[model samples]
Target: MAKQQLAVLITLLAFLGPAACQQQGLHICFNGWLKVPPLLSYLLCPPGSRTTNPPPSPSPNPAPPSGAGLSYDYYNNNGSSSYCPSAESLVKDAVKKAIDMDPGVGAGLIRLFFHDCFVRGCDASVLLNTTTSKDSPTDTEREGPPNKNSLRGFEVIDAAKAAIEATCPGTVSCADIVAFAARDASSLLSYGKINMKMPGGRLDGRVSFANETDQLPGPFSSLAQLQSSFREKGLSSDEMVTLSGAHSIGKAHCGFFSDRLPPNPSTMDYAFATELEVKCQGNEANMVHQDYQTAYVLDNKFYQNVRANKVLFDSDDVLKTVREVKQNAEYPEIWERKFEKAMENLGRIVDVKSRREGEIRETCWRVNGAGY
Candidate 1:
């Protein structure tokens, strides 16, 4: 590993401890790949890839899987009144305050939750309940259940609750707790000036999706597939790309798009595909997926790579309409503005009605692990 990367990895280990680092693999837990470290998370990524943080390591860690599961642990775990959010009126008040303070989570994760609920039916199972131990292939590929990294949103919310609980214990609802947490996390990224609305009264739904394995987007989607997927979830074509900006902070495992790279090239742009292959192959699997922290910086680099035709997926390339414009004199300007607007708008889809039909899972795994 590069000296700088090694330093970052070591620093993260010191910070998050060996136990937390052990449950590193989000996809495959193979050997040789670097364990997902807290600091150098971006090392495994192909600079511009966008599906997951790190890939599976050759010798994956042995930490207990992370994520929620069906069991009513969230709303009913600690104690109904203690863990649940406050009454609907209090939730509304808290949400109103939260949006102004942090809009990213309020708009992003909360909006994501709403979108998931509307399409597949309300079920927080769309949010990961816990780290799973089953094979990925076993999933139905339907909507909900395995939201992939969407569950990470819970991590951000947990942090927010740490602070909120200090001020108002048992009074805030878990649903509002997440809403506020999302807002705060967004403020951390947007400098707290973005326009956000907090929809309150999202009482925690105690039900999770029966198929919680699908619902999440992947790295290999075609532009059309992505458009259709997003549209199905109530998002527009423009919003799909905008939400992708969320990639500005996340990472993807190389395996997610290894095909997009050279040697095993798919239908991706040539230059981009070649570069991605080189980057993916060059890194040691152990060190690649082992790094997950560096994946969250929002810079112009991701967009530029897409412009260079070096992006990993067809979905990413579809946003490159700027390169396809032949005669329109206003294309570049319009594209730039639209891209920014979409991103901003993505952060603004907040409202109380957002939680119409969803229910939080007691356990994230399966509603009933038996035959149901």
Candidate 2:
């Protein structure tokens, strides 16, 4: 019954769009209920059914995910047997050092975490022990079709892991380190404006399969296909659009978006497509920035690009057609704030109750030796 009601609510949300819902005074509670005014409460939350906690007031310091064993500073917990006081700071420092040498590395770090979580619940499965140099064929997430020869910034993770391990040996999990580095990278990339207190204490998983890469949405996904992919991951369509803002700092190989080349005058901008054709002509290896105007910044400019029909992917281009989402490009301070919340929700998708039960890999790549 509750499932049916939730399904019905989702259908309504799909029809109404988030902005329309907001205009109608419909509030989406984090608990998955639509918190409405007393007049509409019976229709939304229902009488005597599950109740949602009131939304938290916006604060510089937000609370961590509940029951996650995660905290703003889990490694430094004085009561813990293995305590590394500066665990997070070490990651931030490493991220800064790497980004200083190559600013593009910061975006790569963010993409790394996004890909990892989408594939295997943010367990660092994306960081499995497999590399281009290895001739020994291994079936790991790193070897997956979507990830092979694509994901970068592995050395950045390696540097952070080395720093954490040197300080506390076996205290921090590689998964937590990856999450922290991604958080630090985004903070640094956005000049500290987009900051979130990332939860710690996530454990590394021992299993990683190449086939699981299907969980990731492709560049060519239609609007419906993209929504369904995000839906499967417990994200809303609004959140999907919000997360797409990260593409402000992203790039894609030409081959990935070749179908749009020559441009479909309807969805994509013709002048932009012609320019890309010249830029990528005869070179499948060339990379195109998701937001050509500000390829290095993390902001809502990606939405503006979509509004101009200058985006690279069909998924990104479709965002502009949604009235609620297109508003993210104009007066989008609200969109930036929602981006942070959506990211927090993305990080929360992984269940952490069994974190202590999972192994802590000695290296970000390989699992720890026997009895970890």
Candidate with maximal lDDT: 2
What is the alpha-carbon RMSD of candidate 1 to the true structure? 15.2
Off by over 4 Å in 1: 1-123, 127-153, 162-170, 191-195, 210-213, 263-275, 282-295, 299-301, 321-372
Q: Lowest-scoring 10 consecutive residues by lDDT in candidate 2?
A: 24-33
| lDDT (10s digit) by residue, model 2, range 184-226 | 8888888877887777777787667675665576665456556
RMSD of each: 15.2, 12.4
Residue pairs clashing, model 2:
none
lDDT by candidate, in order shown: 0.40, 0.70
Question: Once superposed on the true structure, which residue ranges of model 2 sit more than 4 Å away at CA?
Answer: 1-67, 130-137, 351-357, 370-372
* Candidate 2 local lDDT, residue 299: 82
